[model samples]
Target: MEAMVNNICDIVLKRLYMPRVGILWTSGNHDFLRWAPSGELTWVHYLSGDFTKSSNHANNPCYIVESLTDPYREAKTLSALIIPNISLDFVSKLCLGLPFTAAGSLVFGCLDEQLPVIVDDTCITRWLRTIDPKRIDEITSRLCNLGFIVISKIGSTSSSCVLELDEKGWISWCEIADRLSGIGVVILKNGSRLTDEAEDRLRSLGIKIER
Candidate 1:
């Protein structure tokens, strides 16, 4: 996992160039992402002590930095790299001795669905509009083969969801169902099909299904 984290940091460093970047993470869950300005990878760091301090408080506070409306926009405007859904422990490891970087509060649960998030155990995902889609597919495929179930949207505007099934199949769905709660759509891909039982289950929870 450490090796994967290092490789992901290397990818971000090679692809982005910016003065500062924001790493956003939620408490308890520890899911995190790198927020960058202009959707490009570059130099990044936390802009304030708010996020680091939030880790100690039960209720996370909000603040304004870099003249933005709020911390989220500031991070978005200044962040140059993103790695999503990683553990807080890895966040520390990723920032150790790194120049111009800081971890901050996400201020909300989950990333903006529009971003192409890499959902995995290590939170390594593709970023930047200029990044090759084929390369993203390659990484997604490799992770799937290794028994990691990936769930992401089909496109930025689409209401549908895409489920990248792991090698062990749908057995893991129950484990991840809570994460899918309140989600409104699901779209199966790569010859994957949801069993009628599963479909009914999702619908019972108010999730819509699309072929």
Candidate 2:
């Protein structure tokens, strides 16, 4: 596991072509993609299960910002974690306007759908624009750039997508799983349907899939 982690760090550093540092901090069940403002890898520090509790994760300054209000915050990393059982009042306290580069927030909406828990639209937009097929789910329609290798047309009535991955897309499926793992997102795609081989692969890579 340690060797694999180091390899990923190297891949991100080289592929990004930036001199940014990587901070790897393990608090609960998530790993953050921390980079410097100058495009340099700094440190990879893990944090608490709750993203708002920066103090628990080495006093790192974590802030939540909305993409609609702060679009510039969506350059590189994904937004905050999905705080299950968190209330609106607690959300107000957590998002009390901090100065750190806002990663956005996830909220529970009225629809009661299995949504991506993100409150701000920025992270969703960033995810959609990404070329990684796994990252390109049909949940959000804001930035439909995820239709590169596999086009997922949004249905006005259904939240689920009927997927048919191309050979090329299937080959790069691991990349999507890795990206999601790095960002701490556990999204079950294709209505949670998958072959035993696919499930085993994702599990070995530390990517969570819905059973």
Candidate 3:
């Protein structure tokens, strides 16, 4: 099993050309994509972090972006090159603003439908548009670009925040199982869905997983 895994990794390293880093920091569950801005590809999975150094992976085509927004502080800057492990439940609390599945309603209107996509503070356009009332969903859903979830604060402080998207945008516990079932690049603990067959396929070619 280990030899096969290594061989699969070798193939993936050969197939991915330029690797861009995107960070996913959820409090729970695992298996997500990380985007690398410096590479030919827009984003790469966390597990295949070494793709740039292995085989022809550096030549395989991918997306590229100059900058990214930080989920921790809502700051936009040059993209990060590393991936951080975070918990699932903690992130969901800040993201959905809705606990699990609460009758399809949320503390704030934004998280009701969209799992990720928060009203980013760095971009005035997102903030301005969020308060418009008409485009709240549009604004909140925008967090998808940043790769995080958004939730509104109830009162007192009343600060809206963001949460990172898990492999399948599992901000709510109810969504975690389904997200894990889908194909994800990095096989983190608890990510049983990342079968050997799946890894072998990703090693050889580009794959698109539906949300």
- Candidate 1 — which residues are off by over 4 angstroms? 1-55, 59-129, 153-207
- Using lDDT as the yardstick, the better of models 2 and 3 is 2
Candidates in order, TM-scores: namely 0.28, 0.22, 0.20
Worst 10 residues of 3 by lDDT: 101-110
The models' CA-based lDDT, in order, is 0.39, 0.33, 0.32
- Expressed as tens digits, the lDDT of each residue in 118-202 for candidate 2 is 2222333343455554543433231112211111122312323222333322333433421231232234544445456555544
Residue 44 CA displacement from its true place in model 3, Å: 6.2
Compared with the true structure, what per-residue lDDT tens digits does model 3 show for residues 1-211? 9999999998678545433333332322233332223434444322222223322223322221112122222112213222233333323343454434221122122233223222212222334444674544443353332344332322112222211244532233333322221122333333234444443333332223322
Best candidate (score: TM-score): 1
Model 1 TM-score (2 dp): 0.28
lDDT of 1 by residue, 1-211 (tens): 9999999998677555534434333223432222223433332332243344322211112222222335445445442323335443443443342212223323211133122122332323324224554544554454334322344333423442333343334533444443441245666555566666667656644466665
lDDT-superior candidate, 1 or 2: 1
Report the Cα lDDT for residue 85, model 3. 36
Give candidates' CA RMSD values in order. 18.2, 14.8, 17.2
